[model samples]
Target: MSSRLARTSALTVAAVCGSALLVMTAVSASGNTAEEPRLHDIQGKTRISPFAGKQVTDVPGVVTAVRGFGKARGFWLQDPKPDDDPATSEGIFVFTGEKTPDVEAGDSIRISGEVAEFYPGGEEAGGQSVTQLTGAEWKAASKKKAKLPKAVGLGADRVPDAYAPEGKGDEGNIESLKLQPRKFALDLYESLEGMRAGLRNAPVTGPSTEFGELWVTADPGENPTPRGGTLYGAYDQHNGARMKVSSLLPREENHFPKADVGDELRGATTGPLDYDNFGGYTVRATAMGELKDNKLKRERTRKQSKDELSVATYNVENLSPESEPAKFERLSEALVKNLASPDIVALEEVQDDSGPQDDGTVAAGKTLKTLTDAIEKAGGPAYESRQIDPEDNADGGQPGGNIRVAFLYNPDRVDFTDRKGGDATTPVKVGDDGGKPKLSANPGRIEPQEEAWKESRKPLAGEFTFKGRQVFVVANHFSSKGGDQPMEGRFQPPVRESEKQRTAQAKLVNSFAKKVEAIDKDAAVIAAGDFNDFPFSPSLDAIREGGVLTSPMDELPADERYGYVFNGNSQVLDHAVTSPGVGPVKYDIVHINAEFHDQASDHDPSVVRMKP
Candidate 1:
């Protein structure tokens, strides 16, 4: 039978379960997963804290069985419990696959799998969702003995090559003497057949490959629309070779391999994929395939989420429009060329309906129109930008262009079935003007200072749809720089009450989160923008308490924090706050290192990949 059939036959019925879903916060391994209590532990056990706060740790276990996905794989196992009752954890398993195996269960003759925590089509289920393995390994076989083949040198000069009996592939890397490919074949016996290679077929389940091998299938980009200046890389032949992409070949079905660690791969890559910048030169893969202890380590990335959305937020600091139609056109050119085209963009310091500012003319409507038009000019779809036009309260540096917020988005992401008005309403006036009879403070409101230098503050809100889901987005820009509230005599040091503005917005966000939650329990709400605070801050604390929202930024590492300064301290104010099973949005520092404020925005732009 073909390798595909062999694998299916083996996984007839699964017999393991565990903490079904975990709020995964790190990469996972399949085989020997166990470091601490892990959100994902394929075939392993741990007693660590079960909160989403465990920044990073490994769950230990042993090789049970490996399963395959299109381009990745997950392993299965029962996490060890306090009473060590294997029967109780039998129905659940941790996942670990793809070459990296550093995990193992009690020795040999063991197995594992992962449970679900939260995902689309999964509402009643909440807790642990096993999607990856952080640790795993194989143990000594308890059986009498296993078979061995003669003359095993796997491959090299005269070691011979593997050949598919059915005659597939150009056979560049497969050895001629090998019988066939076995999923996770490299880790099994050092050698197989006379050629020392296992059949490039399905894995063996109880000596029969009725179940599938831990190998994934990938669909290489058919059109080969390689980027203009990218460099890509991948590994091949059971960690024996590496392939740096010179150019993208047309994407074809079955062109790419789906797998976890240890499974033979075509190669690995990090981009500059198609761009000329990297040329055809060698490329490096930050991570590679290998078996660690016994676990199959794999990267954490769900290309598609339930909502099927990806978001990108930028501080596009000081993006102003030109008064001159001619200069305005040039400014538009810069936006198209530099500002990355993303599904959703939340901007700060953008010129709105107001006039010009000292830095640039980020006037609202026209500025947005120019940006969207520019994007379309450069082979992109048309878009709309929105913001709330409020009175300027600048501290004297030109009050005309002080409102700090704008968002550019793709309407296709929103489901019109549950559409809501995508406009800003809350009036957030700060400072002496007290802004319109004082915008009602959310749950926790703090007094704003008047006897000090302060910038205007406002909250931006928008609504959209994703994956049959309706969601709302609230963006904001609080007072920049520092200030103080004048006391009886001396000035009281400025407290980062910026959180108050955020908290107020947070209340608005909370109101919306509830509004959306009421529509669908799984309804997702995201409040994102530059918060100007670190991961753990009072301002953020207040917002969380007020909005009852979770933040995707919480999953990021401190060193990986966005928005940097010369002193080395990082301020993680930019965020994408979510509700329910919303996100751990894909974010990046988008490093544009420089000393000048204009080099890159004083604040970093954050990008989050939506479920889709």
Candidate 2:
């Protein structure tokens, strides 16, 4: 007897070939008399299995695929005859411990096991759970080749128009969401979990080189952006339409085909649907089609007129002297070629001279000098750098890195208004100097010791004269959204706890701008940098509450207003908010980075050209 038959005793003899006899049997070594259950009976029409905690005798299915490498070694089986209800899947996973299963594709078998719900990354992660059969016993009913069930089509017709249902239920809780298989894509994916699925001509939205995962959207999706990716709205519903595609075996040969944005995975992408920590419901591919490249190109913003002062903002992803000099050179090229070497550039994340080493050094002079030298070498204007170093490790970033916001001005075009008493802890205040608004301490920190900025980079306010017109510039690097729950987490309307600090920071910046406006109503105040929040977020609203400043992105068309891409959706975290009376500004979110695999920085620089 085979290992499959060693654990079971019940048998039903049947003839497959004329001479070969096949036995469909179920037995329990524990001597418990239990009836056999069908695959559909165990996998009811819900996100979780109906027979999750129960032990069953016989569950018949044909082996469709086998995965032997992972910690949870398992084989996927599909029932020949499926239930009429679309909400219930016909396939299930059978966990076979550390050893590889003897079962092969096309073999019909009957499995007896305890149904269990396994949460990857543990239950504390608040991630989705996978239902499988564990402590299993199985017997091959037929060694003769059995045809596998047809892969369920996941094209536009099969997938629902809406990514998720519109109701009060928890959207992130896949098991709790009211299953509307016909109305929402998320419901359909959840209902079809553990099933063999196929996507036809799915367009790749995000390509992961490290993990070989392809974020794709089936064709006929609504609100398709120009770059062929779906627009992720303020809500999490848009993510439902996008799915991650990977291989069951994490090997070079089995890896998902390389792709970029606007590329398409033509033909069928056949795989077994599974849920994991990285993405909610991912399809572990057994077979993939050819990758069709869309030839996406990087675009450079048009050069600004010499008379128009161009201001730009960029997050340099922690730059320091110890960092790779190649990065500085590449960044210089981006500034010169992509942004036209703006008259003034607000640089964020400039690390201390020693990078992340915790030796208590706070000055970033060497770091800025290296970047400026490279800028000049790259044929850009020689820029003069200005910044007040933060207290060692006081500003939260890479510990001891002392990352802070700074400014680079082209001396030929812009002049920094030098004043006394600018230091790491000094608070710059709006003052009346001979009846005109002036910064008491030029290039000073704005309320550095405030609770909101306790462990965050203080906003660096600088006074500059562009073409003899005085302008106040505030460069900020607000608290990041690090602790926010993932959009695909179990919590509905995923919590963004980082918003509180950012909102408080925005209000402080707004109040400072209001004071400058009070001194001079038409003060050309430009607050620009990585706010670490979206334009539609409450933080940006706080910045715009008093109408002291307005986001220049608001002037751009909705589809083209993004400066960053996260989870395959083009969005903006970098912004330039200017006083109401600034100019008919020409704003461009230069696409040098954020979309490419070889990007120098994670953010694309945003440029605003206006007569200041």
Instruction: Identify the candidate with maximal lDDT.
Output: 2
Clashes of 1: 173
On TM-score, the leading prediction is 2
Query: In model 1, where do residues sit more than 4 Å from their true spots?
Result: 1-307, 323-340, 353-363, 392-398, 412-455, 484-508, 566-568, 593-600
Q: Model 1, range 276-389, lDDT digits (tens) per residue?
A: 111111111112222112222211222334445756566655555544454344333333443344556767767544445444434377767876776687655566665654
Q: Rate the local accuracy (lDDT) of all candidates.
A: 0.36, 0.78
Candidate 2 clashing pairs, residues 3+ apart or interchain: 8-27, 9-27
Cα lDDT of model 1 overall? 0.36
Can you write out model 2's per-residue Cα lDDT over 160-247, one digit (the tens) per residue? 7666543345434456455678987767877787788878888887665455676777653655667776665565436566777876
- lDDT, model 1, position 194: 7
Worst 10 residues of 2 by lDDT: 15-24
> For every model shown, what is its TM-score relative to the native structure?
0.40, 0.86
